[model samples]
Target: MSKKFFEERGDQSAVKAEIIQKYFATWANIILPTAQRYGGGKIAYIDLYAGPGRYKDGAASTPLLVLQKAIENPSLSGALVALFNDMDVNNTQTLQSEIDALLGIEKLKYKPEVNCNAVDHDAEEYFATTKLIPSFTFLDPFGYKGLSLRLVNGVIKDWGCDCVFFFNYNRISLGISNPMVQSHMAALFGDDRAAELRKNVEGVKPALREQMILEELTQALTEMGGKFVLPFRFRNDKGRLTHHLVFVSKSFKGYATMKGIMASASSKADQGVASFAYSPADSSMPLLFELTRPLDDLEGLLKKEYAGRTVSMLDIYESHSVGRPYLSKNYKDVLKKLEDAGDVSVVDPDGKPRRSNSFADRLMVSFPKVKK
Candidate 1:
C-alpha cells in the first residue's frame, strides 16, 4: 500500500476535517437553493479520488458526509447525483460496498452510483453524459497527478459546475524541485506546459514553488474563461501546508458568499471553537485570514455592480438567484443611495412604486413585504 494512502485513511487531523466540512457546507448553502428551485434539475456531487466511507479513526469520510448532507438537506431537493472514483480496485470496491450498505439503510428519493476507475479519465466522460447541468465536484486527490487542468476545465464548461479541489502542493513542489523527478511534472500539468514551467523556475524555494504552481493553476482557470476566488492553504498537524483550495464561479456574488463563509470559518477557528483556519501563513498567527483584503475588494465589487445596475438590490439578488448572509447593511445603503439618486427605483410597502430624485447611495433596497 502507498504511504500517502495510509496517511489519508488514518485520522486526518482536526484542521483537515474541519476544512473539508466547511467546503461541503459552503457549497450546500450556495448551490442547493438553485437546485431546489429549478424544479428538479440534476445536481451532481462527485468524489474524484474517493476513499472508504470511514476513516481509520472512525470519522465519516468526506464523500459519505456529502452524500448524507445532500440526502438530508431540504435544499438538495433536486436530483442528488453522485460519482465516486478511486484508482485502486480494492479501495473502490470497499467504497462501493460502503455506499451500497448505507443506501440500504433507508429508501432514498435519489440514488447515487459509485465507480472504481481513474478519476481524471472518468470525470470527463461522466460530465459529458450525465444529466446534471449545474454540478458540484470534489477533486480531493492525494496528489496533483489525479486530474489535469484540461480535464477539469472541460468538465466545468460541459457541466457548468462548481468544484472544491484539494491540490497537493507539497507533493507537487517536491516532485518538481528535484531535477531527478522533474519529468513527472510533465505528466501532471502536460508536456508542453511542463516545459514552460521548468523554464520559469530558476531559484524558487519548495514552498514558494508550490505557491507559483497555484498561481499558474489560477491563471489557467482564468484563461479557460472562468474567474476564481484566490486559493487558500491549510496546514496539517506537523505544520506542513496542504493546498486545499476552493474555487467558485466568476460571479461577484459567488465570491462574496465564499468570502463570508471563509471568514466565518476562520473566526470559528480563532475562538478555538472550530477546526478550519484561514491559512498556514504563520503558526503564531495561523488563525488569521490571509484573504481578508480580497474579500473586502469583493465587497467593493458588489458596490460597483450595484452602482452601475439600474435594478433595485432585491431585484439584483433575484437576477443572481441567491440570498446568502453576506449581503450586508452597507450594501443596502448602496442601493438606497442609488434609489435616492434617481439611478434605481423601488416598490414601497403599499404597492406604490417610488422613484427618488436624490442620487445618494444610502437607501436600503428590498422587495416589498408580501401581502398576507
Candidate 2:
C-alpha cells in the first residue's frame, strides 16, 4: 500500500546508497576514461523526479550522491546541472532546506539548480538549456506513466544524453490491469500498443506482469537506438522481489560498471547461488533476469566461449557478452561437468594446468551424463 525505504534511518541506506553511489561512480569511471581516450567534455546528472534532498531514513539521497561524486572526481572537471522536479510544494520546501544545510556545511564546487515543477511539464526545457551533451540522467519517477517513450527519445536523440530509468514494474503491472489506467497506458504505449499489451497481459498476475514490463521496456529502449542490459532483480528481507530495474545502454560505459556492481550486490546476498523451482508462470514469459555470470562458472563459459583459440578470461567474458557472476554460477559447473567427461582441460590465466582435465575421451562419457 505504501512505498518503503530499503534501509532504516541513520543506516547507510544500503539499497539507496548502493544504487545511487554505483550509478554515479560508474558514470564517472566511464566518462573520465572516455575523456582521456577521445577528448575532454561536460557531463551532468539529471534527476527527473527528484525528491526531497534527504530522505526521512537519513540516506544520502540521489541528489547528494551525485553531488558527492562530482566533488570527488576533479579529473572529470564537469558542471553538475542537477534538474530536480517535484510537484509537491512541501517536498520542494524540504528539499531546499536540505540543500541549504548541505551548502552551509560544505561548499560544492559545481553549482546544482533545483526546480519545483512536475517532470512531464519541465523536463524538455530544463534539459534544453543545460549543455549536457555527454550527460547521464536518472529518471527515478514514482510512476511509469510519468515518463513517456517519446520523452525518452527526446532525451537521448535531441539532448544527446543517456539514462538509467528506474522502471516501477509493479506499479505498471497494477496500473494496466485496472481499466481506469487505459489513458495513462496510452500515454506511454500508444492506443494500439496499449491494447495489444493489455490483450496479451490480462491473465498475468502482479509478479509476471512486472517481468513483462521489463521485457517491453528493454525492447522499447532498443527501438529507440539504445542497447540495454537485462533487468537486475533485488530481493527484500522476505526474499520477495522488489519492483525496480536499472537499465543501461551501449553508448554509456556506465552500464558495464553498473553491471559489475549489480553482480557484486547479488553475490554478497548469496554468494552467486540462485536456485529456483520452475513455476507455471515461467511459461512463455519475457522477463529479463541476471546480467552477469560469476567467476567459477566463467571458467567453463570461457572454454565454450573460445573452443577454437587460446583466450583470456576477460576475453571470454567479452566474446559471449556475459558478466562475472554468470561465470561463477553456471559456467563453473559447466567446467566441472566437462572435466569429468574427459573432453576439456581447465587451465589458469597463465595457461598452466589447474587440474587433470578429461572429457568423454573414450566414448564412454556422454554429454549429459546421468549422476549416480
Best-fitting candidate, scored by lDDT: 1
Top-TM-score candidate index: 2
- lDDT: worst 10-residue window of model 2: 358-367
My TM-score estimates for the predictions, one after another, are 0.66, 0.70
* TM-score, candidate number 1: 0.66
Worst 10 residues of 1 by lDDT: 267-276
Whole-model lDDT for model 2 versus the true structure? 0.55
lDDT of 1 by residue, 1-372 (tens): 432454444323344455556665666566666666764555667777787677666566777777776667655634566778777877777777777776432544566676677665566666655555566666777666656665566556632466667667767766655667655565456566666777676587766766567666666667664565445456654456665565645555555555555545452232112233343344455544333433344344554555533444555543442322233433454445544665445554445445554322233443322234
Error of 2 at 203 (Å): 1.9
